[model samples]
Structures are given as structure tokens and as C-alpha cells.
Target: MSLRYFDNLLKSLYTVARMNEPAKPDWEKIAAMPEFQALLKAKRRFVVPCCIFFTIYYFSLLYLVGWHTEMVKKVVLGHLNIAYLFALSQFFMAWIIAFLYTKKSSKFDQQAAAFLDHAGFKK
Candidate 1:
């Protein structure tokens, strides 16, 4: 694709990023031997601690933001408020978690696919 098209696509994605909500997890995929459990266990080990830390961090931000919401509202950037940016930072954290998840899941998927192919389940 051309750079302009790619740029437009990226802009569209950014707009979607601002508007999009998180998805619901699939129980059927959890039920399948899709390596999600094992991968999930591995992911969970890292994620759990990170989540705890983030939960604390987030609440602390909430406290501070509440404390300084007025001051923050005054310090604006191109029509955006600090509170919205702070809230958006939380989404960025979630996005980071998701990116890590996708990378790790891709690794698990590669291994699982290889195993499945070797075991005569190639499809």
C-alpha cells in the first residue's frame, strides 16, 4: 500500500482506538485445547502482579487527579484535559497488556500449530 493510504489507515485506527471498547473473552476458546490455558497461566503470572501494581497506581492517580482536577483542567492541550489524558493513559496500559498478550499468544500459536501439524491434525 502507498504511504498516504497507510497513513489514512492509521488515522482510522487511531479514531477507532479512541472510540473502541474492550472485547469479551471467549469461553469456547477457553474450553478448547488451544494452548490458551497454558499460555494464559504463563501470561497470568506476569499479568497478575502487573495488574496489582497498576490497580494501586491507578487508584493513586485517581486520588491525585481528584485532588488536582481543577488545576489539571486549567493545564490544557489543544482542547484536551489532563484528566482525559490520564484516563487515556490507563487505556494505553491496557493496550500494552494486549500487545504483550498478542505476542505471547502468537508464540504459543506457532508452537501449537507445529505440534498439531506433526500430530496429523494439519489443516
Candidate 2:
């Protein structure tokens, strides 16, 4: 067969496949729900501040390393410089944030479940 015929066949198959899929949830209704709105608010309350804090922290480290190398070089430990400590602390900071987010997300999950239950969408 020709390339155009093969492309048309694929397009028709894709359309059929999409048509067979189940209906999606009504997001407008979900968004209007109080529980869903609260879940979104909770996420924003945690995430936005955390993101801003981390951005400032990461930039401050960059600024120190870039323009204040002499200060960062001062040894706080036996041989490790302040820069090294700060760099290592970034990893720990990420882990701590992730741990806190995990804890916070459990509450969001409950809120989501409640929304679904209220909406009669729970399976």
C-alpha cells in the first residue's frame, strides 16, 4: 500500500482507540468542591514557601562561592572549608524538605479521598 493509505489507517485506528476509552472525571466539578480547593490551598501553602526558601538558599550559596571565595575557604572543620559544608548541607536540606513534603502529602491525600467520596467518584 502507499504511505498516505498507511497513515490514514493509523489515524483511523487511533481515533477508534480513543473513542473506546472511559470517560474522565469532571474536573470543573472537582475544582469547585471545597475539599479539593482546600487540598490545593494546603499544597500551595507548603510548596510556595519551600520553593522560595530553597531558591534563596541556593542562590546565596552560589553568590558566596562566586564572589566571596576567600570567606568560604575558611576551614570550619579539620580540613573542610565552609563551602564544602554548605554544599553538603544542600543535600540534607533537600532530604529534609522531601521528608516534610511526604508527611504533608498524607494530609492532602486524605483531603483528596474525602473529596472523591463526597463527589461519589470513589470506586
Candidate 3:
């Protein structure tokens, strides 16, 4: 066996080892990036208001059901009462919120991908 052969084998092994290991992003550096900060701010701007609105809307239903029983019990449709309609509206509300978030997150993801590229991180 030649010394050059052993050196080549070692090099091949090192290369294989590196290829098997996934590249790790530097969280601290990523966090420090202005692009990342802007992404977070943008997400916060959307998410905070959605969360606040959803919470208030949800609690208001509970409040109406618990305290304003007469109001909620009033018939709005042939069979559906205000409470039932309100409860049903929650499902639609959740779906709407989810749809909005999904739509918004795609933009966020694009921004994040750009951020990663700018930061020299592999996707």
C-alpha cells in the first residue's frame, strides 16, 4: 500500500463525513440580522391583531351565552338561534384566520428564504 493511497483514503473519508452532516445555521447571527428582525416585526404586526380580534370575538360569544342568555336565545332563522349562529360563525372565523395566516406565511417564507440567502445560510 502506498502512503499516497492512505492519504487519499483519509481525504475521501473526511469528505464523506462532512457530506453526511447537515449544515447548522448560526442562530445568534440569524437573530442579529436586520432582515430577520424585519420579518419578525412584520409577522408580529399581523399576528398580534389577529390574535387580539380572535380572542375578543371568542370571549364575547362566551359572555353572550353565559350572561346574555335571552339575547343569544332569540331566534334569527327558522330553527337557528343567535347562539347557534354565533357558534357556527366561530368555525368560519377560525377558517378565515387560518386562510389569512397561510397566505401571509407564504410571503414570510419568501422573506425568510431571502434572509437565509443574505445571511449565507443553506436552506
Candidate 4:
């Protein structure tokens, strides 16, 4: 019974999360070129650190939620009633991080796109 429910949940997630535009990485072209390769390396460096930061940030929230749920009274705010400022801070930080990532990724992607165009690749 639980297995069937879990399978349906996974299917629902797959359906909703399906990509509208799939990523098309040009690794072959990037690998052949020197500057494009450096751009790839720089992009990776920027991305990996941001990923790690968010990963740790979220993991700490999970840990804190588990640790603090015992002390905070769960209250209803419309639908969710998790009444805790600590939890709210986590959510706020998540939004701030998301905004930062969008800005950062745009900058990096723009730089990378320029480099790729200069390397004889189409945008």
C-alpha cells in the first residue's frame, strides 16, 4: 500500500518537474577551445561553491527544525502553522539565496555566452 503511494508521488513529481527547455551543453566544442574551456572552468567554480553553500544552508535548517520543533508552538499561518522564527529565517534566507543565484548565474552565463560566441559558436 505504502509502496504504491510512494510510486504515485514520484510519478507526480516527475510530471510537474519536467523541463520546458532542456539544457544543451556543447561539451565537444567547449573542450576543443582554450577560452571556452576556461569559461567552463570559471562557471563550474562559481556554480559549485554556490551549490555547496545552499546545500549546507538547507541542511542546517533541517537540523535546526528537528532540533527546535520541540520548543516552538506550531501555529497556523493560512495553511502552514509552523510557528517558529528560526524556521522563518531559513525560508527568508532561501529566498535571498535564490535571488542571489539568479543574478549570479545570469552574469556568468552572459560572460560564458560571449566567450562561446567569440569562439565561433552560435547563441
Candidate 5:
């Protein structure tokens, strides 16, 4: 059989399986769970600081380029100027944050699994 045919077959099987599964938990029940609350708190702790830092860091570049054009144009190394370097640094900063978030998200997944188990729900 073709790959596309197998893919469609699998999708139909998945839909059938989903239809047979138990109902999802209510949102209120999930919200009341201590483990779920801890998950939210943990996520906030990691996410809020990263967001604030990224916003300030990104905007500072714009502010400097717009208001302090001469400072931004000054050569930092070889022919590369401060603006070029700062803009380049943004790419690295984004990659670093994504890496960190990926690592942290695994922990969040674990927490979510534990919460599911605690709630007597099968994954």
C-alpha cells in the first residue's frame, strides 16, 4: 500500500480509539489539584523572567539605535559595529532561551504526568 493510504488508515483508527476513550477531566477539577497548581507556579517562575528579560533586551537595542545612533555605530571589533554585534547577540540569546525552555518543559511534562496519575487519569 502507498504511504498516504497507510497514513489515512492510521488516522481513522486513531479517531475510532479516541471516540472509545473515557471523558476528559473537568477544568475545575484540574484547577483544584495541588499538583496542577504547582505546575502553573513552576511555569510562571521560569516564563515570566524570561519574557521580561527578552522584552527589555530587545527594546534596549531599538532604543540605543534610535536615540544613541553614534554609540551604536561605533566600531566594536574589526569592522563590526555595536549595532551589528548587538543584533547578532539577539539570535544567540533567543537560541539560549529556547534551549533552556526545552529543558525546563521536560520537567513540566513530568509534573503534568504526575498530576494525571494523581487524578486517576490514564495517559
Candidate 6:
């Protein structure tokens, strides 16, 4: 092949590689954005409370299981003790919280997308 053809091939490969790469966000601009700040605040508002509540719930359950054996052993259903129910409920609670967070985060994603588009970050 001619040198000219080789140069053209290299340029074409470089162009294709660059095209496939995602554009990097301007971190300085993103950090300075009011929308981004609001996103952080909104995320914290949901997450902080969730963390606090779950921490309390988990510790209380642990305490009850460790210190209140009689209370935890009391049958609530057909041979299902309070401890058993509480243990099982932890799985359900986790799933429910995860589902809720997924639902909530979609809204945040939408808002973030809009903000990015407004800031000329989206292609």
C-alpha cells in the first residue's frame, strides 16, 4: 500500500475509536451546577434517613434476639417464633427498600440527564 493509504487508514481508525468513546463530563462545571448540588441534597435527604432507620432497626433486632430470648421465642404463627418472623422480615424489608430506592433513583437519573443535556454534555 502507498504511504498516503496507510496515513488515511490510521486517521480512519483514530476517528472510529474516538467516536466509540463516551464524552467526559466537565467535572468543574458539574460540581458548580445548581442542579448537581440539588441532586446531592436530594440523594442525601433520602439516603441519610434510610441509613439511620435501618441502623436502628437492625440493632434493635439484634438486641432483642440477644437479650430478650423469651420475647423472641414467643410463637406468633403456627410454630413460627417472633425471632423467626423478625429474621424473615429483614429480607423483605431489604428487598422493599431496594425496590423503593430503584424507583426513586430513576427520577434522579432523569433529572441528571436533563441537567447534563442542558449543560451540553449529552450527545
Candidate that scores best on TM-score: 5
Model 1 TM-score?
0.43
* lDDT digits (tens) for residues 3-122 of candidate 6: 999999999999999998988777998788998888889999988998888888788899999999899999989999999899898888888888999999999998788778877775
Model 2 C-alpha lDDT per residue in residues 43-113, reported as the tens digit of each score: 99999999999999889999999999999999999999999999999999999999999999999888888
lDDT for 61 (candidate 5): 99
lDDT of 4 at 111: 76
- Candidate 6 deviant stretches above 4 angstroms: 1-26
**Candidate 1, position 32, lDDT:** 59
* Shift of residue 104 alpha carbon in model 1, Å: 1.8
Q: Report the error of model 1 at residue 18, Å.
A: 58
Task: Write one digit per residue (lDDT tens) for candidate 3, span 5-43.
Answer: 999999999999999887886789879899999999999
- Which candidate order results from sorting by lDDT in descending order? 5, 3, 2, 6, 4, 1
Model 3: CA > 4 A from native: 1-29
Write model 5 residue lDDT over 26-115, tens digit each, in one string.
989778899999999999999999999999999999999999999999997999999999999999999999999999999999999999
lDDT by residue for model 4 over 22-75, one digit each (tens)?
667677876768776777787788778877887887777677567876544566
User: What is the overall TM-score of model 3 with all chains considered together?
Assistant: 0.75
Off by over 4 Å in 1: 1-45, 108-123
Candidate 5, pairs of clashing residues: none
The segments of candidate 2 whose C-alpha lies over 4 angstroms from its true place after superposition are 1-26
